[model samples]
Target: MTRFNALLLALLAVAVPLSLLAGRVWIDPFDPQLPNAAVIFIELRLPRAVLALVLGAGLGTAGAAMQGYLRNPLADPGLFGIAPGAALGAVLSFWTGWAASGWALPLFALIGAGGAMALLGLIAGRGGGVLLFTLAGMMIASLAGALMSLAISLSPTPFAMSEIVTWLMGALADRGWAEVWIAAPLTALGLAVLGLAGRSLDALSLGDLAARSLGVDPRRLQALMIAGIGLTVGASVAVAGIIGFVGLMVPHFVRPHTDGRPSALIVPSALAGALLLLVADCLCRVLPLQGELRLGIALSLLGAPFFLALLLRLKRELA
Candidate 1:
């Protein structure tokens, strides 16, 4: 796992720079012939690359924390209403033309995510039992999805609906530094709060009684975990537009190689997530498609097979 973390560190250094050097721009790195090429590189490509890395790392880290806490590999912020709630916000923005200013979209998305989590907590009440939390999240996710569908269907213009749908497919296209700045603070704060979550989760692997004997309060950890996931994942969704599977898949990709130690999976999982999204974004840059490929679609195309293989392996293990 340490070696894996070291490898990821080296790769992270190269990932952003290489991604900046890519995109639809055909300028040679050595020879700057295109007018405003440098500006384009700085103002456009640079931010999108940074957004990819930041958003990917956030999702991966949140996913690892969630799986550790819940003891469920499939546990994710999306499973709980965060991603769908953010999507609802983005959809509302498109429907009402609020995103014409570009800044309102992410802000709305963040608000939506926060609202969903708050609503869940209010309904489920104190003590934060796992089943109650899970159920509340499902309700919120359902509500958010329904609202999003209604927004799309009721949009005044067909073009607006198409715009919403395209954005929902997700991309890092033409993102700016302002978006990165907006998402970074919340994501970083959440990451810091959950920095020790892996170790806590290691303790939580024991039964609740055992964990309590060891000074681990499940309720406190649950609250911290939820806050961390909400902030990190909500910020990622606000910026990245519902890029799925990275959270659900990254820990699995890194876990087996790391001696199957749950706590040790966190850092490597995040780095692997960064690598996955960076490569996906770079591939989207070169694909010969109208308006380029959507980042979420590109990821799904890659990850669906992996998911199916995982299912088959689980089936065999059961057999």
Candidate 2:
């Protein structure tokens, strides 16, 4: 499993750079237009690939942390309503024209995600347990999605409505180094926090009573872990809108290599998440289509089927 993870990481190292060269505008090094090509490479292509890597890893590691803490296979930042809350914030900012204030889009999105986390915790209540928390997440996510739909339905103009729709669908198009810088640091910090909590998560798998018997403070661990996820996944949602399934799928993909150790899944899932998104982003560039496929749409097309398969597998296992 360790060897497999190492190989995957090595492949990702090569894949990310290759993705920069995958766009529709072909760059010839020997051509007289090389300088223009270099400009495009530096400005657009590089940022897009870097974003897929950073944001993807953020979602992945955040999901792993959430799943480990909850001891649930269905746990994910998106599923838990964090990303949708962020999306609602960004969409509201755009719709109401409040994002004109400097950095309001990302700021509002972060606040929204944090708000959703708080709301979820509140609904879960004291000692509510994982089942109650998961149910609360579903309710919160549904409410957030409904509110977004309401905003779209009440949009003042067709153009505004279109913008809302496009933003919800998500894209990495035309993003620049500024977006990369904004997301990268927040994600890195969150990942570091989650990494430090890895041992705590391992203890958690033994159940709360056993973990406490071992001197592990389960509540403190849960709070810090949730905070880490909010920071990391919120940054991703702020930048990328609502790219789902990376969080949900990456941990499952790496589960085998982790030997079922949820803690061990963290780094590998993060790496795999980045790799998957880069590959998907590369396909968005090279695939023949009427218009470039949105990253969110492309991911949904891929992820939805995997989700169904996962459900079926669970059913069979229970059977």
Candidate 2 residue pairs in backbone clash: none
Name the weakest run of 10 consecutive residues (lDDT summed) in model 1. Answer: 203-212
Q: Using lDDT as the measure, which candidate wins?
A: 2
Q: Which residues of candidate 1, in runs, are more than 4 Å off?
A: none
lDDT per residue for candidate 2 within 158-226, as digits (tens), equals 887887888778778877887898899999988998887788888878987887788777566756666
Query: Roughly what TM-score does model 1 have, to 2 decimal places?
Result: 0.94
Q: Which 10 consecutive residues of model 2 have the lowest summed lDDT?
A: 26-35
RMSD (Cα, Å) for all candidates, in order, is: 1.7, 2.0
Which prediction has the highest TM-score against the true structure? Answer: 1
Off by over 4 Å in 2: 29-32, 100-102, 125-128
Judge candidate 1 at residue 56 and give its lDDT: 83
lDDT of 1 by residue, 1-319 (tens): 3887998889888877788778787557888677888898889887887788778878888888877777777677687787898889888888889988878999889988888777876776777566787888898999999999999889999999999988898888878998899878888888776776666788777766666788877677777776788888889878778888888789888887786655787778778877888879998997777778889998888778877888898789889
Q: Each candidate: how many clashes? A: 0, 0
- What C-alpha lDDT does candidate 1 achieve relative to the native structure? 0.81
| Model 2: lDDT to the true structure | 0.83
Question: For candidate 2, what is the total of clashing residue pairs?
Answer: 0
